[model samples]
Target: MSEISNNFLYEAIDEDIASGKVKADEIHTRFPPEPNGYLHIGHCKAMIIDFGTARKYGGKCNLRMDDTNPAKEDTEYVDAIKEDIKWLGFDWEDRFYYGSDYFEKDYELAVGLIKKGLAYVCELTPEQFRTPEYAGNTTTPAVSPWRDRPIEESLDLFERMKNGEFPEGKYTLRAKIDLASGNFCMRDPVIYRIKYVEHHRQGTKWCIFPMYDFAHPIQDALEGITHSLCSLEYVIHRPLYNWVIENVDLDYKPCPPRQIEFARLNMTHTVMSKRYLRALVENGVVDGWDDPRMPTLCGLRRRGYTAASILDFIERIGVSTSNSLVDIRLLESCIREELNMKAARRICVQKPLKVVIDNYPEDKVEYFSVSNNPNDPEAGTREVPFTRELYIDAEDFAEVPPPKFFRMKPDGEVRLMGAYIVKCVSIEKNEDGSVKEIHCTADLEAGNGNPLDGRKIKGTIHWLSAKYAEDTTLVLYSHLFTLENVADIPEGKTYEDYMDPNSALRIEGAKIEPALANAEAGERFQFVRSGYFVKDTKNPNTFNRIVSLKDGFKA
Candidate 1:
């Protein structure tokens, strides 16, 4: 059995179970995502609460698609949502469902309210009703001209609206809850609206659709959900959610789903709004919703983040009722720590500078033993090829050495990582003064150990044998947006204004160890001194840098 969570959400559930309000074995939750766009990190938290809480109690959680608004809903997003949830180690079992599955029931519940004199058909459009003449203030309640329409007339007009009788937005069915209440949602809110669009699943079977606040509760109650866990934004809407449950007649009466609010996950350096994300895709600022720089789950996965690292980050953050911004570096640290112990080590030269071991036999080749992962004793070691000609990262060498620089310098000694200690003898340069070939003589007898003369070598640099290296592509990524929090963009500035143009950099013809050539797509590796990377699933011989080896987060 899973351990019990000490968070407020679980505490409340514990209280409910203690009071017999909810049977411990009957604890049920759900993750209902609208099928419009890809799931972002924000959704991951909700998934954890819904599925994790259920797991804690050995209960069940449903994966329901809140595909209420069909304007942009598609099976494409639906499939992606399921894949993402499953990738995060969650399973809804046999309880998969769509919001449209209860459309007929939603319509029936609205009609039931009309017959009971608790609802009426409103003729005002949203624009007209939101005006001062109709919208009420703290001292006054909003007025609806059709609030008192006869129940019989309302029943007929609602039926006609559903039968495609009126054009879109010409009529609506609103609940007659309160006209002078402080809560605007209870002030004769429209429960249903007319939309002349085809539903992704329902087709054109109906024209009028129930709004989210109205449909969500009904779906929850019907599904026998005991706890409705949602983001903190819905705390104010809880009143309307309960009002719907109390007024509308339903079969699952004794135990309606209790709504609990928790803070949403807000991360630094990225925007989670679907509208802004769509604009980025439509405007060609990003490759797509799955762009590595995007915060979408698929984007993170493609960028080399494993489910374990993301869950670890979430666990460290814990659950809170108040809103806060999390530094992206915390997320980077999690992946770095996991990959350091798990990912196999490899050699990659981003900007290759040729090196020729002059004293090494030209016709001879040797192999050096290197640990696949130094932190894992069971990982064992692999043999790395060493030849007369090799390539090292250009940054590792300095024609002019910087202060305290331990790497290669003029006539300086450095170890060709996992091989022999070598000292630079001469360098060949191009016309522009760029390094072409660095000539060195290796201490063949040292063999990846201290020099026989007891000379100390501080620099150890990764290198790939020229004959055994393969050309590959490397894509480096940075923050998607320049701003730390796109949620609070400066006034008069759009999210697009903060888009970082250099978020992703692609380098071609980078050299990697030949063994890396056999790595399948999605395989992860640590490139020695560089960051962890994954072979791009869509591109052959290409790797995307996941996170740098450095951890900027202090904690």
Candidate 2:
């Protein structure tokens, strides 16, 4: 928190508090997400700001479900959202609310607008009033035909609409704001629309539902949210937001909520839209919303990302009003930074090749001392079992060495990490000409720094004793898309056209050190030379690579 030096939202709030527009000790904020889909990585940014800002000011934040359109909402999403927020370490206390909880208040406010002649029933169809009025800041005003409907008649219609008298789309209550204004949102925007569909929470009790623009301000006003933080797309809607608060008669709040906009997080290789993500799930392009390749919070969590790591990423990105694309590597850097300190060091040869120590007695088994975490002396050490036969990654050997290639070629010497230096004697091949086994002889006294072991082995590799290794699987993940921005595809080609074919690569029967056989679910480890990985929650003996040991994405 001390590292964050400049934030416009905080600056704005300080000025508001100074001006006495907001109470010094009563500062409140809210995260009003519609219960339509699972919260993604982008929503994490908003959550931190809304929850963090209130916390910073020694106040509270509310978790409000702005569920006006129940057509797309469900209790499933509501529960999931709450879980996600709590998982990220934020609390709303007893301030949890739904927009429908204030339906009575919203309806009364709408009636007040009607009584003031500020709102009227609109008879024009969505098509008739669908003029591109907001485009280029100069669209001709296309007023609704029922703009001047008599107060008595419109009030009766509105009441009947609430009583389920009108069918869907027969009439809409629109705010009678400027018709010729440059901003189309202020140009008589619809405040309420009649929908016969059943609400997830309200059921069939409400046939006429308040639009988002109408419900949001009322919700904020009722909750006394001093600062309404949102993404930059809501910047143009600020005036409309204030207009609703100004026109509505509400006594819950002495001051309207201050609307502040900041840039949203956008990454290079992932799409942030729920609709697109849903398509991927429904089409079986990905396993589910929690698929590791997905950018959703659940997906990242399942992919072995720590909550602290995500928070670190958010802090590094900072908050701004200007939109920009963040390099995905920074996100990876967050994971790498956090995991390096805690993830225990282990030896796991992903693609194992049998290496037999021909000079060692077959009945002998030795345990070697290795530091668990070199940076933390208190972490101490553990003994890894070593046997006459062991397994190393197949890539560590080359039958015909390339120029300057060092690791275990025939008759080449190398150091076995945490064990003795060994010299390869011969290579065995299969009928298909593939190398089957590597035969080696270890310098027995080398690991203890004996005088006979004086050598600089440039090729040091990790290994696991075949006898003490557990048969495991490693599930590696790559970017979901091949293109830098899926939106940059050629004409007629959809975002799925760039779906990465190698997004997930699974290796079976991989050998992991026996000590990890019972590693708890969600436990993380650094596969010595490979990467950071976590034990899969659903699949036993299966692990998911959180990230490579180093950054691979440059741009």
Candidate 3:
């Protein structure tokens, strides 16, 4: 929605509607997710495309839960998914659905398939079915001995299976496709399995659950979905998808819903696998699903990533069929661009070093005016306390100046941002030989527009009045993985092997200007030259650095 250019996905939808392949009234789409885990960034990309496409075409989008595996599915995940979708600025508007809601209809459809001799009851256990000897090549699918059973017996067994007559995994309803088809999915894939576990949504209403391949196409058709878009992995499954629709007798066109595949989003330095992410949580490697290092939407939100920024990121990435690893810097760039125009400018020193103005009166305190945002004049300005004692970043003062370092050093003169120019006179060292503090003398005569102030200083540094500055905590976050291509690790090593141990650093004893004392949670600001940061919701006083200001001079 933020001034995005035309892409193939949009062009295809437009062409379809213009060519009468799809009518405006029939342009419904749905984002079908399995409610087994938290939605990640990859899922976010799909949701934006799914809902964005529908909305642009004056169609409605449905949020459907593919709650087929009750053992791993739960209402917690269902609720989280909905909350995330809403947070991403999308709404399904009462078009919410669940695959479990069609249990009765799915059962009847399975029964019809049995009556048509296109499906049968297979007694093979999962272990035996997975064996190399049992699972032959696509040219020679190992025939199931039970496939020859009569339709009446198959139908009866399927009913008994649903009624809990047999234990879980004893029998399964499989499509009676070719035994020697080129496509492996067409070689008698499993359509239904007997699972005695209670469903999160339906409770104990049914024991037989439809597989994704069996339920997805039917649900799309039932919801009148015109564009059944999915990732490229489903390309091989399309034949079977159409087979089910064609075989099922329906009042409307059986194959009106078409499935299209696009390459999924993959980013460098981050693992998108939900299973691995869950392992990180379960093993205590990270805090939880919302850990700042995670790629989950909740994690991004907690890390001060605005929904608008994420939407902008998705827009920049666009839709593509070819796969590529997007640099994480691009995401950071998008966030920086958004925050620069919106976030207020403030001052906070992560590592504080005491600076004493020797010549200034110790009891005196004055207010220095500073602009809230230089980009917008109407943003106004606020006054910050200036006193004899102040705290500057420890790195700002170099005991021995490095080459090209323009910051404070012995005998160096610098402007104390918004205050008078000061020249360092001497350094005080502790017993440990560490520079404890730096003493400077402010040139009071060189006030604003003074004749002597015509001279320029190469360095200008931000500081907070030591007397009025508040002590607070600050969190600095970095990339989760050390390596760019986490998936390309050594054979035995996993993506976790490349996890960065210093991805998050919590710093205490940080000092902020008195103006930031009233900063509330969810408020974002550019912390002077430090970086763009936001107040943590969990701890209002604590600020988390989102991204640093770009240093164009850096190679």
Candidate 4:
């Protein structure tokens, strides 16, 4: 496990404790995500901070669903969020909650603000409100004809709105804060709006929903969150959050939750936007949310990333107040480093080419001992079958070898991993001019040892007995987008313009050894000289390449 470095986020908490503003043990944080889509890699950073801080201070963090808007929210997303968090090794204990759970209190607070003359029901259409006449300038305040509606009238209209008496755009409840404040979020932002969509949890019992800006702070305070950690995009809304905390008369809680902002995670070659991801799924550009190519947590998990590796990546990147694009290779390197030490070794021949040992007995089958993981002695060893006919990756052989190529060539000698050295003596070509079979003579005296003459063999390759190999599918993945950073797409170009057409390549009928047929879904293994792969949970006889064997990232 990577240790958490001392960053400004922790420094702020330290200062709070030093100043007696908040006790170290009183630290409380919340990860409130809108359960409208699957959680992606960007959410992982926030999740770490939320849970890591609580663990650091012996405090508690709550997992709350910011499901104020019911349009896209669903119990499916809610369940997925919890599963992803737990899979990442964080525990919320008994602190799971939903924003809609506070809907009644949100309503009561809005009404209280109206009676206090700090809020009113507005009738301006969204478009009209955005017009220059209503969108106040620095000198001119925003104009709202209903800004001064009587408290009783606003209260009655709010109740009627809740009763489904009005259309979606007919009315909105807005806080009567400054209309010309430098921070526009305080320009009487909408506290509540009419949504006819059925809430995933609340059902049709309520027709109006609270906007996130209004509902979030209240939810934080109600949950007794001492630190409301969120991405840097919400920094501008800090004033509004503080304003709500000061004005709202939630007497039950004496201390208001403090809002802290940190930069969100952005990675090269992939996007974290839920809208873009949803479009990818909807347009059939990708398989689904858990498609190994997507950046969603489930997607990464399916792609064979471990929770510890992800946490290690997060620790290496650390927390930053400024936004920057991190190299995806850094993440790949973490998984590679982890799998190199942990994943068991297996033989898989993608694009198999037959190698017939002409000198070996046709009825004989020999087993050679091979280490399951060379880096892990306790992982033990497994026996691999070697027979008269074997399958090696077609790429390992080249009839006309390129310079510096050390694999198989005509009349060349190569060592079959865990077995004897074989010399390619003859080849048979198919009608398509491709090598159909390579007839090789195995040195029987070499056996599982080496050549008796001590002649060096330049090439070594992995192979599986053709008779014992199981046909399986292998899904190879690459960058989803060709662009280094999808965020830098040209002004008029959409992400689709940079989407890689061959992001995922599926190879069917790939030959895997009999040992691999017993691999359970999600079990990871290193394909000798190929890459790391994991069995697909939703597919039969299929594996997904987690990452290639090499990356330039040093850490």
lDDT against the true structure, per candidate, is 0.90, 0.86, 0.86, 0.91
Ranking by lDDT: 4, 1, 2, 3
lDDT, model 2, position 492? 85
Top candidate (lDDT)? 4
The candidate with the higher TM-score, 2 or 4, is 4
- In model 2, which range of ten residues has the least summed lDDT? 130-139
Would you estimate the TM-scores of all the predictions?
A: 0.98, 0.96, 0.96, 0.97
True-vs-predicted CA distance for residue 488, candidate 4, Å = 1.6
Q: For residues 362-455, what per-residue lDDT tens digits would candidate 3 score against the true structure?
A: 9998988899999878889999988999999998999888997888988888888888788899999999999898899988988533328377
- Which is the winner by lDDT between candidate 2 and candidate 4? 4
Give the CA lDDT, 0 to 100, for residue 380 in model 2: 85
lDDT digits (tens) for residues 37-86 of candidate 2 = 88999999899988888888888899999899878899988998999998
Model 2, stretches more than 4 Å misplaced?
1-5, 131-139, 252-254, 447-453, 552-555
Question: For model 4, what is the C-alpha lDDT against the true structure?
Answer: 0.91
lDDT of 4 by residue, 528-547 (tens): 99999999999999999999
Candidate 1 structure, TM-score to reference: 0.98
Instruction: Report the Cα lDDT for candidate 2.
Output: 0.86
Best by TM-score: 1
Q: How many clashes (backbone atoms < 3 Å, residues ≥3 apart in a chain or on different chains) does model 1 have?
A: 0
Worst 10 residues of 3 by lDDT: 447-456
